[model samples]
Target: MQDTLSNKALLKATVIAVFIAGLALVSFILPAEYNIDPTGIGAKLGLTALANPKAAVVSGAETKATIDVPKSVQAADIIEVIIPAGRGLEFKFAMEKFKKMEYQWQTDGAAIFFDLHGEPEGDTTGYYESYAIATLADMQGSFTTPFAGVHGWYWKNKSAQAVVITLTVSGEYSVIGLKK
Candidate 1:
């Protein structure tokens, strides 16, 4: 009788384990994509797209991107975009410290390390930030406008040859007081 009871217990455990495994397999097959703003925020009003200038690849050339701040851009708002590269590029920012907006790669891509300093204010206020130290990989979200202002995207060629990167911007944000 003891042996019979043990067999019944084992059978029940195996059945339960199989049911859980089937549930996990179904979850894996479901959709996993989530839509997010360029700033990394969950959702916001406005459209999003890659915000970069025209790109060209020239022989024996080093690819670079200069973040251009338009005169019309307000001080309190931030613009977001992406810079595409062949393999990958090293990102350097002009700010003493900076933050990376949230993002997702359409394909398998390299990781990025964001170095930021100073204190974060409002939502993203903090002293230092990094994509490397922190858990974030590729940045693909929104950014908070700084008090003094911030701009520029510097990248290095990850491949043996030259590469051209078009500034890629995503998401839409209101100008605070723009006419719309």
Candidate 2:
């Protein structure tokens, strides 16, 4: 009788341990390592950024084809753009493979949804990649092009008021233009 009781307790303990481990893996490891957040907790905690270092590389390659920019842009472009409420804009520059660009942009204390991405030229398939997706008042970073194409930002103002964006870029790009 005692042996039977011991076997039941051991089986129960083993099952409980496995269940707890599975929960941890699904909730934490899956999001932080693979960006697979079925539970949505990873996105809320910002753990999604930790997955897939290649996301930036894929974005640069994909963004190279999406927008059209001038083939002869200056080495430095400073532009201030105002986006009215509920408006959006796309600004991009023509870049070559391995070219590097430093950029910074800021809003007037109002947050906006921004996509930093790239689309390759001559890709009519309408495919692009995203390096970053942010909802913030400002962003600053530098990118080394993974492939030749157009690279830039698409921003939308969902706020109740107009937002001013001041953008500064210096790099190996040929031209920068706003997509109309």
Off by over 4 Å in 2: 1-75
> TM-score, each model?
0.27, 0.58
User: Scored by CA lDDT, what does every candidate get?
Assistant: 0.32, 0.73
| Model 2 residue 128 distance off true place after TM-score fit, in angstroms | 0.7
lDDT of 2 by residue, 29-108 (tens): 99998889999987677676567321111121122322234433333455666677887877777788888889888987
Cα TM-score of candidate 1: 0.27
lDDT of 1 by residue, 116-158 (tens): 2222333355333332232223444445434322333323334
Candidate 1, residue 167: how far the Cα is off, in Å? 6.5
True lDDT of residue 113, candidate 2:
98
